[model samples]
Target: MQTLETMRSLGLLTPEQYLEITAYVMVNSTPEQILAMPPHLWQAVMQADALLFPGGPAEPVH
Candidate 1:
């Protein structure tokens, strides 16, 4: 799973911008794809979704 800190460090994202982008990605991405992510990256993706859109509906899980 990628942390906000690590994503920032990796230049994949900045801590602040990652929240929305990660959520969008997670909603669209498959469970298998997400599961394949490193632990820190997975957590960051989940946390980003939860933070930006608490209780919000994700994209259809396909």
Candidate 2:
């Protein structure tokens, strides 16, 4: 399995995608679970994210 860093470096994913996916992933999965997820799954999550939360995930109240 490719690490996210490796994928990013290989130009398989952009910085924005990384941030969006990583943010959603951090909120949804465990660290161990993320390792098992493929890039396609990340994209799927990103797509559904917009539909599931039209306004985007709520901003953290600082």
Candidate 2 off by > 4 Å: 30-41, 44-62
TM-score of 2: 0.44
TM-scores, one per candidate: 0.39, 0.44
Pairs of colliding residues, candidate 1: 1-38, 1-39, 1-40, 1-41, 1-42, 2-40, 2-41
Q: After superposition, how far is residue 52 of candidate 2 from its true place, in Å?
A: 29
Instruction: Evaluate model 2: give its lDDT.
Output: 0.63
Error of 2 at 54 (Å): 34
RMSD of 1: 9.2
Error of 2 at 40 (Å): 8.5
The collision pairs in model 2 are: none
